[model samples]
Each structure stands twice: as C-alpha cells, then as structure tokens.
Target: NQFKAMMDSANKYNVKVIVDVLPNHTAIDHTAVLPALDEAVGGHDKLYHANGFTPIKDYNDRYQCTTGEMGGLPDVNTENPDFQHYYMTYVNDLLSLGVRGFRYDTAKHIGLPSDPLDSLAARNNFWDVATGREEVKGLRLAVPADSLFIYGEVLQDKNVKESEYAEYMDLTASAYGHALRTVLDKADFNADSLLNWHHPVDGKHLVTWVESHDTYANEHESAGLTDEQIRMGWVFLTARQNGTPLFFSRPAGSTRENYWGNNRVGARGNDEFKHPEVVAVNKFRRSMSGQPETIATADNGAVIVVSRGNAGAAIINLSSEPRNINGVDTTLPDGDYTDAVYGSSFKVNSGKLSGQLDPLTSYLLYR
Candidate 1:
C-alpha cells in the first residue's frame, strides 16, 4: 500500500522512479549466498563460486574480477542459468508492482561467461537476460515497449568507457563532476574551457550531477565545492542542452556535524524545496529543453556566454570579481530580455547580448 501510494504521488508529479538492482553479489547472509556457500562445501549444485580465488583488486581482469567475492560478499555466478532465472523472477515481481526503470548497481561486475576481457561486447551483452528478455518474448508483460529507462553505475575513467554502456543505459559521468569541481575553485575560471571540455557521452545519454550519493556522503567537504559553488553547478547542470541532471540534497545537520556516513539521515530542511533560485532555474530548463546551444567563452575562459538557439542565453562569471561580458552572440532576435533567475532586464543589440555577472554568480537570461 505504501509503495502504491508513493507511485501514485510520483505519477501525479510527473516523476519517474528508477529502482536499483544489485546483481553482482548477495549479502554474506542472504538466502542465495548461504545456499551457494553450503553447496560449495557439500553439494555440486552451487550458486556461488566455490573456493574463491584471491580477492580481485583491479577490475581489469573482467572474468575473475566479476566472479570473485567483493568485500566478502558472496559473488553470484551470473553465468549460471539457474541464477539468471531466480534473479529475473525477483525483478519481474518488482515490475508487476509498476516500476518502469532500473539502475543496475555494479553492472560491470555482472559478466557474461564468454568474454575474458570484459569487452564492450561482454559488458553490454547480458541486458537481454538481465532485463528478462532472454527467456520472455518482450521482458515482463507489465513492461511496455520503449517505456523502460535503465542506467548503470559504470564509473567512467580511462580504463572504463561510459560510452560502451550507453546502449544499455546512461552511465554516471563521475569525471564530469570532478572536472566541474576543479574549475569552480579557480579564481579565473574560464567559461570557454568548460565549453571545450570533452563530454564522456552524448548529453541525452549521460546522467549529469554535481554530487552523487557516494560523493555527497564521502567527499562533500573534501571535494571543496562550497554551498554556493554547488548551487551554481546545479544551475549549469539543469540548464545544459544535454543530459539529465540530478540534484543532491545535503542533510541539515550533516554539514554541522561533518558526518559522511552512508544511508544515515540528518534533519530535513525546507530550504532545498523552497529555494527560489533553484526553482527558477528548473523552470528555465524545463521550458528550454529542445533548443540548440551556441557557446562563446571569453576573458580566457573566465566568462562564458551561451545562447540556446533563440530560446535564451546564460552568462556565467566564474571569477571572484564582478565581470561584464560583451559581444556575446545571443543568436536571438534583437530585443529586450530579462534574466529568469535574477529578474534583471537588458537589451540585445545586433544579436549581441551584453550583461554583467556578479561575483561567483550566473544569469539565466531569456525573453
């Protein structure tokens, strides 16, 4: 009943829920893990790896890395047909409860039996089975075609390519957040450099965030993103032409107590829900979702101007001092415009939008 109530509220608010699935390993005490361990010691019908090899440190060895125990959690031998059936049954039950999406946790660890290197082919190879399509004609009957959204926690790096998993689901752009944190700390942060940085995947297929659960709980203070900087990142993340942005809500007392423990809750605050600046920017992004982007970075990347194909322009000043950005190609009809965030009016002349950015502030301007 509570689940139904939650889903009803989400539907009322046009929110899509993505469930997290952990298919790599079972808890040390989980029923499946216990049985598997029992089978390993007595019977041959084991669900887990018996006599597990040396704990896998580097995940480069795709085969052993996926099958080996992680932190003593019993690694599920996903290659086994029996395990796949049991896993999908659990997933289908959730599907029947009206879930439409999934976020596969440690998806890269769910390896196919055929690939030795955890190649792109192997990494993306198990969706058919894992998604319940391997045995069924079209996933669960409750799942409608083209309605299921899935993403994975495939943390991207030089060794791990986020693009390889795009076909399955959007991969978290962890590096993108790190890059944003790095530049936001600079006294002369260049807006142009931000524009020129290589994105891991196409915007549509990337899940962009300023902070994730891991980062928020573990690295918030250490990451050096002040509250103001985090808010600025939120504005940019939401206003971008590509990617879906997720906002991280910092617990109220966590800031004061400096507690970064996982899944622990602090007092709730009304500020995140009622913040006017954040509310205004979300509206701006919602209204300008399909517009093309024209970017111009100047002042050695200190001031970056963006025109969203006549929909609007965003002027960002990353520096500590106030900055006046001029000669920005707005790509809009010459006319008067106002910043949606700050509510300041300005004039556009000859397609050039001129504006002043306050210290460490951004202007979300539009007609």
Candidate 2:
C-alpha cells in the first residue's frame, strides 16, 4: 500500500524513490529485531560490522571508508540471511509499484558482505521485484535482470574501491565524487584546479553534480550556492562524461519559486528549490547525453579543453583575466566559432583561435 502511494506521488512529479534497506540494524520499534537485540541473537554478524563499542546513530563518513550513518535509523545486519530475505521481499513490493530506479540511501552503512554474495544480494533483490522478491527463494523466476536501476549514496566515503563497486552494477557509486560538491560548497576551494578531483573515468561509471538534498539539508551555508556559481558548477557536470548524470530538481533562479514543494513541511518555514538555470543545463545535457563520450579537462586554470571522441577538438580559457597564449591544439574543421559561456564567438582558422572568458565563465566551441 505504501509502495503504491509512493509510486503515485512519484508519477505525479516524474520522480524516483529509493527504498531504504538497512542491512545492519532495523528500526528500534521493529518487533522482529527485538528478539535479536534482547535474546541470544544469532547471525547477521557480517552484515553488521559493529565496532568494539556500541554503535551510534550517525556514522561519521569523513573517515572509515564505505560506512555511513543515517539519522537515528538503526543499521541493518546485511550479512544475516534472514535480513537479506526480508530485504528481498520488501524489494518485491516496491518493484510492483512500477519503480524505475533506486537510490541506496547511506550505502556505507550496509554491512557490506564478502565479494559478489553481498553485492548480488543487494542488486538481485532489486530486479526480482516483479515476482515479489522470489528470485533468491524457492521457485526462482527468470526476472528481467536489467529492469531495475541502482545508484548509491556513497556520500563522503572516498576509499570505496571501484573494483569492488564494478562487481554489482554498471553505473556504480560515485568514486567519492563529492569533489565537485566540495568545490561548490567550500568557497575558499572554488578554484580551477578543483576540477582535477573529478573521478569520472573510474572502473565504474559516475555522473557528477554540484549540489543535492544532502548538500542543502543541515549545513545552511552549504545549501544555497549563488546562481552564477550553480550554473558554472553544472557546466562541467552537464558537459562531461561517465554515468547517467542525474541533474538537479529545479532550474536556475527557480529555487525562490519553491518548484520542489519546499513549502510542504510545517517546519521552520524552510522553502526553496534550485532555480530555472537548469533549463540551460538540460539543453547542454540533451546535446551531450550519451553523445559518444566527448571530454574536456583543464588543471590549475591552464586551459579549458574538450574533444568529440578524439575527433572534434577545442580549447578555452579558465583564467580570471584573458591572455592570448598561442600553441593551438584542435581537430575541428579549421574555422570560426563562438564561446558558449562568454557569449562572444571565436575564429578557428588554420586550427588556431584566441579568446577571452569572463570571470567564472567557460567556453565550448567545436567543429
């Protein structure tokens, strides 16, 4: 019933739901978990990598790679077969709701199992949704394996290895891709070199972003990035390659409009969403979406560069002040073009061009 209700809401707004699966601990009120906590609880040891001390509510993500802490939600013992089965069953109902993809909230909290067993359990449950999660049980069904999609909330865990992640899904966890977030949030660190930290080409796929619900929730300072800054942040994400880059909720300047139902909660009157500038972002995304993985990268403001699958080529400026530093490298049909970020175009005659970029702006011109 709740799954149906959730799907109904998602359908209304074209959104997705990520059913939380706590493989380490269950809710404090969970009757099934009472016996485990009180009696001689057996199993679930591997699923719950408890420290020598009792577990706390929120696991610190800044350290101890591959671990996270949800708000007071008890971690589930992912290693326990019973818990796994229960999770699978829950997935069945969720799938029946016509769910498209998943956002594994607080992925690090999972008592990550050994090898493919844990990984397979986590993903198989998702695909087995059609048969009410019976793939792992008696009368296994040949569920359409590729139906369900999975994306993880890896958060700040940087050390989550790609090799380990690739075992489970194709588009996998962000390789601690929070570097983009760090650059956007940390004002002092918003320099050009920050782009170097983007980890898109890892063994698994990754789509980058500048902000999200996690960024805006608690830390007020981190929540609201400026319009220009947000656009600039997305310019890289929308234009770059890797995983299916899930964009923001609202467009630029639309945040003040509350497009995402910000006024719903009777909270301290906290209401706002991303602005409508995302329109431009979607335009860029639409143009580049699965478009042969063209790429451009620059470090330390040296150059703003790009390539259309090593075919089309481009180079722009990232410095605060423009300078005509020659030594052009491009594969464009030698001619002229315009810069998207700065607005004024350029000439690519003889495979050479010079241009200027406004502060915090970029350029994308190709053949």
Candidate 3:
C-alpha cells in the first residue's frame, strides 16, 4: 500500500523514484544471519563470509575490505553464487513493483570477481552476476531494457577508486562536495576548480551534489557555509556544464544530535523548492540540457559567465560586493534580456553581455 501510494504520487508528478538499497550488509537480527551461523563453513554458501575466508588483519587489505563486517552489521558474501541469485530475486521483485532505478549503498565493500587478494577466484563479481548484461537481459524480458537505471554509492578518496566500478554504473562524485567546501571556506567559490575537478573517471560518468543527508548532520565540515552561501553553492552545482546534479533537502531548523548524529528525520519542511533562485535555475537547467559550456571568467576569477550552447547564460558572482560583469561572451544575439531570478534587465552589445551582478547572487539570462 505504501509503495502504491508512492507510485501514485510519482505518476501525479510525472517523476520516477529511485530507491536506495543496502546490498553489502544486513541487520544483526536478519533471518539469514542466524541460519548462516549454524551452518558449517562452506556447508551453506548463504552464510556471511561463507567461503571460509579468514579475518582480515590489515585495515587496508583488499580481502578485508571485501569480507569484513561494516561497523557491526553482518556483511553478506556477495561472491556466493547462491547469495547472488538470492539478492537478484529481491531486485526482480522490486522491478515488478515498478521500481525504475536503484542506488547501491556501500558498493565498494563488495569483492570483484577474480580479485588478486582473494584466495578463491571462482566467485562471480556481485554486480556482473546480479545486474550485468546477462542479468539485465533477463530483466528486460519482463520490462523495457532502458527503464532500469542504477548508480552506486562508491565514495572515492585516496584509497578508494571509482574506475573499478565504472563498468557497472555512475558513481557519486564525493570530491566535488569537499572541493566546493574548500573554496567556499576561502571566500572564493571559483567555478574553474569545480569544472576541472580531478577525478579518475570522466564527468559524464559521475553524479555531483552540494551536500547529502550525512553532510547536513555533520556540521564541522559544511557549517562554514551558511544557508545563503549554501544556496550560492547550489547555483555552481546545477548551472555547471557536466554531470548530473542532486539537490538534498534536509529538515528545517534541524541540527546534529549530540551522540546519535542525524539518525532520525527532523521536522518536515518545504523549503527546498520554495526559494526563487532554485526554481528559476531549475527551469533554466531543463531548457539548457545537453548544451556545451563556454566559460568567461573575470574579476580575478571572482565572477563567471557560463554560456550554455547559445540557449542561455548564467552569470554568477562569488564575492560579497556587487560588480559589473562586462565584456562577457554570452554568445547571445545583441538584444535586451532579463535575469530570470532577479528580473534585472541588460542589453547585449556586439555579441557581448554586461550587467551588475548582485553580491553573492546569480542571474540566468535567456532570450
């Protein structure tokens, strides 16, 4: 009934809802956990770490990463063929229920088939076994082949690599957030750094976000950027040329719990789409989809003009003082234009645009 209601709302809004799943670990009291415990090693491949794999001693050991328990939750042995088929059954059920997309949580913990560190090499890669071409072909027999979309929560740092999972699906560009926070702290939210973020994979294969559920509850890292500053950050994220942008909506007036963190949802708020800038920029993004960016930077990199394939241009100001964005190559016809967000008017002269960008504000200009 809950899923039906959700589907109803999704249909009403003409949107597709993606569900997040924890494929790596399960609760301590899960049904499969107890049964696996009593079964002899290798007797029941459904058990946790059922391959008779020993404990991983080194923190960075590849074997340990794949087989180790994540925080205390019993980790599933994705390498087990029985387990692979078992998990796919659940996925197939969800597919039958009209689930169009999936978000694989903690995907890095699962082992790749034929890992150099694994003592056993026969285990099939979890994704390949569960959702690769063969599995997807079977799924397509039941539904449209292009209907199912999947992305993984493969967070990348110095140790974790995103290229490993590039074959399966897009990955979350976690570094995009960290890098934005860095420049926002320095009071120079330059778009160049973000546009040229050094990631192992190309921008097309990544999903970017300004913040997530976890970041909101943890104040130390993002608290430096105030709510207004955060909104400014959003302009940088959504107005950019590459990668899909995700907008995370947190409860209003919510703070981190002292010990538990943001473990629970706070008071529900409708502030996410209520802001005028967000509304206008979202419309511009839709209109400018698939457009290449022509960047023009000025004011010592404090101001930028992102021209989107001649469809429109986004003029952004990163500093606190209002400055005139002069001689910006918007690539728009020489005519009058209005800022979609602020309603400020400007005239294009000789294929160039000049306007006074308000302090820490953005202007979406369209013909």
Q: Among these predicted structures, which one has the highest lDDT?
A: 3
TM-score of each: 0.82, 0.61, 0.84
Over 194-233, each residue of candidate 3 has an lDDT whose tens digit, in order, gives: 6665678888777887777557656546644555566677
Write the candidate numbers in order of decreasing TM-score. 3, 1, 2
Candidate 2 C-alpha lDDT tens digits along 160-241? 4433433344333233335554554443234434434344445225535566655544453334565455555565555555
Question: Over 4 Å off in model 1, which ranges?
Answer: 28-45, 50-54, 112-114, 117-125, 136-145, 161-163, 187-193, 196-200, 219-222, 256-270
Candidate 1 vs candidate 2: which has greater TM-score? 1
Candidate that would win on TM-score: 3
Off by over 4 Å in 3: 28-45, 50-60, 114-121, 135-146, 189-192, 255-263, 266-270
Tell how far residue 133 is off in model 3, in angstroms. 2.7
- Give the per-residue lDDT digits (tens) of candidate 1, residues 29-62: 5464455544433433355554233377777766
Candidate 3 residue pairs that clash: none
